[model samples]
Every structure is written in C-alpha cells, then in structure tokens.
Target: SMAQDAINRVLVDRAREGKFVVRLKGGDPFLYGRGYEEAHACAEAGIPCTVVPGVSSALSVPALAGIPVSNRGMTHEVTIVSGHLPPGHPGSLVDWEALARMRGTLVVLMGVKNSPAIADSLMAGGRSPETPAAIIVDGSLDGQVTHRCTVGTMATTLTDRGVRPPAIVVVGEVAGLPQVLTRA
Candidate 1:
C-alpha cells in the first residue's frame, strides 16, 4: 500500500490536468510521510500545492504520556529515526556507529522488531551500555507501556518482559535524567 511510484503517478496526472487533490496521509505529512516525494512530483508537473501539518507520532505519544521530550538543562535536542526501511532496503542501512557517537537524544519509530539488533549495534559501536533506553508501546493509547532500562540490558529486558510493537524507542543521556519523566 506504500507504493510511492503509484502515488506519484496519480499525483502527477492530477497536477497535469490542473485538478485539485488532497493527498491525505497518516501521521506527520513531512516526517517519513513521503510528503517530499509527492510535493516534488506536483511541483515538477507545474502544480501549485500547499502542505498542512499533522501531529507526528514522536511528540504526540510522549505528550499524552506526560513526558516532555525537551526540558531546560536536561535535553535540548531530539532525533527521530525510522526503524523500518522501505521495502527491499538492505537490513543494515543504519549507521549505528555514527548514531552512537551523536550526543543528543534519540527516538526511533516502528523499531520494535529490530530493537534487539539496534541495541546490540549501538553498544558495539561505542554507546554506553548504561545509557538509558526506553521502549514505549502503543504510545499515547490507553494501554501505553514504557519500559525503561539501560541500552546494554534493553534487548534482554524487552524480551523478558514481552513488550511488542506499534511502539517507539528512545535513547540518550536525557532518557536517564529523572526530572523529565512523569512522577508516578
């Protein structure tokens, strides 16, 4: 259903015919939403277009759970990454070593299935095993569950606890900062 070429063809045809069309997509239209590709197609076809932003899963989920990703003196940067690649993409496309070397907070979406591998790679690439990592399941929903642990133990912790998909994972120094988490 995520065939970009098919969607692009439709948008291009409509734009060429001077017809107005709303390309509705779930989640933030910009963030991993393929909005850029569609926009490019429309523009190249001489079509005028505008973008209306939608709530991204990254911020919305944390907010609903009362976790403010950014807190003064705690964290100022957050990185959001896609856990799954486009169909047919190589399994090891992520540069785990570079990501590990980064200093800001990290947020990974659609990454439940690959969480174990990701954790292993990050640690192998030099990220601290003690680095705090959290897996948030059904984030923002009534059944939301947040499993917090260090990066070293995350893979085992998640497996032992049986946490599953439709989830997001966060890792960084900020994740360890106690002040930002909701006091339960």
Candidate 2:
C-alpha cells in the first residue's frame, strides 16, 4: 500500500504546486485500483481531480479471448467481482452462493489463487458443475492464453496448465460461446 500512499502524496504535492497531474493506470483505475482513495485525498487537500474512464479487463479480457460477456438473448447481465479472498474468509464480502445462483456472466478478477475453493463453493451452492468456464491469462496482451473448461474442472485445468495470477476467470453460458463464434 506504500505505492498508493506515495501516489496520493504526489498528487497532493503537485496540486498544491498548481500543476495538473494525470494519474495513469492499467485498466480502469476505479476498479480494484483504489482510484477513489487518491481522488478523496486530492479533494480533501482542496485539489480538483478529474477521472478519465478506461476499459476494464473484466470486459476486455473475455473479449480478447473471443468471449462476449453479454450475447443477445444468451445473457443480459454480468457480475464482476474480485477473487482476492477465499469464499469463507472473514474479510471476504462476496457471497459465493448468491453468485452461483445468478443467471449471468461471472467475471472474477485476482481470484486465481483461490479458484479451487471458489469453484467448489459455486458448485456446492447449486451452480451446475458442467457450467462453461474460462481462464484468460495475460489478457489483452500478446502473451494471452485462454483455457476453456467447465466449472467442475476449472481449478485442475488451471493447475495443469500452470496458470498464474493477473488473469481473468469467466463463467456462465457466455463462456462457451467462443466455440460458436467465427474467429477472425
């Protein structure tokens, strides 16, 4: 968190110096990047801060892997969540059971480490084991690798493929649509 502290300090300093400072970050700064903390700090210091929107990996990653989050009548809703915490962890705010029951695309960010537990929770919560799932590593980059499987086998597939962090996990019918889409 020191990095974020440093960033906030710099923003405050630059604003006090009457200089316009733009904070550039990967994906959308507001999503899991603590962009609001910096904005709040700037405002408290009487600095005017402006936010320029950017594409979030939740949308871009699946798209890069040729998986649309919402496809016509297939799905109209998408729920994006952070997978940083295990399902039962006291610090976790995500309700795995609720998510499992949701009939929509599920996009999980930073959840690779706890994927096994997450999958188990989803299945135990009544999500079909055969539900389509995908893990997109290095998404939207030249080194991107997309692994397709069912929710029942997602963890094993990721382990077998040596999939690591900084990846996106997509689940639901939309996840399987890539097979039907014509690839260019």
Candidate 3:
C-alpha cells in the first residue's frame, strides 16, 4: 500500500485547485473502503466529497458462490472482521479468542496469507478444529474458486491448494452447509 495518507492529501490538494478528482473502488467504499476516511480528510481541508454505496462482498461473495452467510434460525448472529493483521499483533483489533467462543458466523476478509496463524488463534481460543471453513477466492469473478476444509485443515488446505490473496475466509458451520468438507 503506497502511503495512502499521501494519496489522500494529493486528492485534497487537487480538489483544492478546482480539479475534479475521483476515487473509484470496488465493493462498498464506506465499508472498509476508506471512503469515510477520505471524506474526513476532505472535510478537514474544507473540500467536498460524496460517497456512493455498493454491494459489500462480505454478504455477496459467499452468497454468489452458493454459501449463505446466514440462514433462518441456524445463524442468529454474524461477525465480520479483517484478518490483515494476524492474532497477537499489537495493532490488530480482532479478539480471535472471543470470536472463537462466539456461536455465530465469522467472516474474514483479506486473510489468505495469515490463514495459518488465524487458524491457530481460533483453535487455541477454544474453537473446534472440526469447525467448517471455506475460502472463496476471486470472488464474484469468472475464475472464482471455493476451497472447503475444517479449521484444523485451513492452513493445510490453503498451502496445498496454492490459495492466494483477494480471498474471503468463512469460519463457521454455515461454510460447510454447501457439502461435505474435503480434508487437506
């Protein structure tokens, strides 16, 4: 990530000069898209910015791939988190231990690389090793691929399948609803 703050400043500076600047992003800009942050930057500089909402992949990705993030009474609650930071990182805001204990769905975005560490954290925090997990890659794209495994085999599945970034990792029973899980 090239100094995002710097880019925000550039956008503000250009807008200050009467230049029409645009920041186009995939998914919802307000939902972890930093649209709010950029808007704040503009407001601090007295520049005007507008935010348009888009369908969040968090709800759409799994849905498009035949995985329902929620069901009738099967899923009472859902917790979405960012896995960019592995568990135990000082900057990480996620409480993997608490999440492990939650009786709900856990959806992690941008966690392909840290899937191993994440798996360990969830398991260490009391999550079942047999908890169903799914990795939806290239979501909503022509090349989309869904990888299924249990929390115990998440790291191995990822490693063995050559899973890459731009993936959404679903850790919960809902993930296994599609079919029987394939062990790594």
Candidate 4:
C-alpha cells in the first residue's frame, strides 16, 4: 500500500544528497500511475521531479490486436478503465453505468479477473446486452490472445475460457469491428 511512499523516501534522500532522480513508471503517470503521491512527497522534501508517460496497456493492447479503438464514423470517444480491482477499489472506481451508457468506446486494462463482473454490472445498469466485448491477453507482446464475445455472454464465456490477468477487455461497437472484419 505504501509502495509510492517508499519510492518517495528514496528519491527524497537521493535529492538531498544533491543528486537528480528519475522515477520511471509503467503507463501514463497521471493515469493511475500513482506518480502524484511520489511527486508530492518529493516536493515537500524540496526535491524536484518530472513525470514521464509510457504507453499503457489500455490503448496499446487493442492496437496490437489490430483493433482501432476510435474510427471515423465508428467511434469518436474512448474511455479507459481498469478491471484489476473491484468496483470499490481506487483503480476500478469508475462509473460503470455512465460509461456503459456512453456512445463511445470502452477500454479496460488489467481487467481479466473482473471482466465478467464488470459486464454483469454494466448490463444490469442498462448497457446493451448485445454490446460487443473482447478480452486481449498479453497485448503488444509475442503471445497475445483475443477472446471475442458479447456483453451478455462475457461473464460465462470468459470464465469458460479461463481468461486471466494482464489483459485488456474492450467493450462497445468498436470491439465488433475487428470481429466482423476478421470473422474472429
């Protein structure tokens, strides 16, 4: 729970010794990177810090699977959420109902464990049951698996297939584009 705090202390001590510190984080620092915590700690200790962003699994994974999240006349807006945590966790504290109700695309990173639960919640909150859904595992890596199904069947289908973590689950019309074009 104090991972960032520990990192901050190290950075602060290093800075006090007149050394410059570079903290590298996975994915966009501002987007659930928890960089803010470290930054704040460094600032309070009179240590200067800069934030650098990395490609996140949210967009990169789908792209590697040949799925464009947003296409002209297809989807204009895209929302990235996390499936790694439960609905109450800070990581998964998204308004699933509102997101499900949006007209744009939905990309869920690290959501394999909770994808089924998430799908159920969205459907219960009025998202279309027929909405296309996909689980992309090990995105942008050598071993990538894409599981295509519908929101209605996401829970059961994903469970039946034993989909795991380190995957991105996409929901909405954009997900159907690849499935239809490739017949996957």
TM-score of each model, paired residue for residue: 0.79, 0.94, 0.92, 0.86
Candidate 3 C-alpha lDDT tens digits along 24-99? 8898988778888888999999998888888888988988777888888778888989999999999999999999
For every model shown, the clashing-pair count is: 0, 0, 0, 1
Model 2 CA lDDT for position 111:
95
Better of 1 and 4 by lDDT: 4
Question: Please, what's the RMSD in Å of model 4?
Answer: 3.2
Per-model lDDT = 0.78, 0.91, 0.89, 0.79
Model 4, range 1-184, lDDT digits (tens) per residue?
A: 4566687788899889888778777677777687788889988987777777788767777877777888899888999876677555565568887887787889987677777778888887789999988888777667778988889998887778887777788888888884433323
Model 2, 1-184: lDDT tens digits are 3788898999999879888798888889899978899999999998888988789999988887889999999988999999999999999999999999998999999999999999999999999999999999998677888899999999899889999888999999999874653334
Look at candidate 4 and give me any clashing residue pairs: 83-111
| Model 2 steric clash pairs | none
For model 1, how does the per-residue alpha-carbon lDDT over 1-184 read when each residue is reduced to its tens digit?
A: 7589899889888767777788998778899888988888888877888988899988777665555667687777887888775222476466777888876777888888878788887777788999987777887667888777888988898889898888888888656655344524
The segments of candidate 4 whose C-alpha lies over 4 angstroms from its true place after superposition are: 88-92, 179-184
Q: Is candidate 2 or candidate 3 better by lDDT?
A: 2
Better of 1 and 3 by TM-score: 3
Better of 2 and 3 by TM-score: 2
The lDDT, on a scale of 0 to 1, for candidate 1 is 0.78
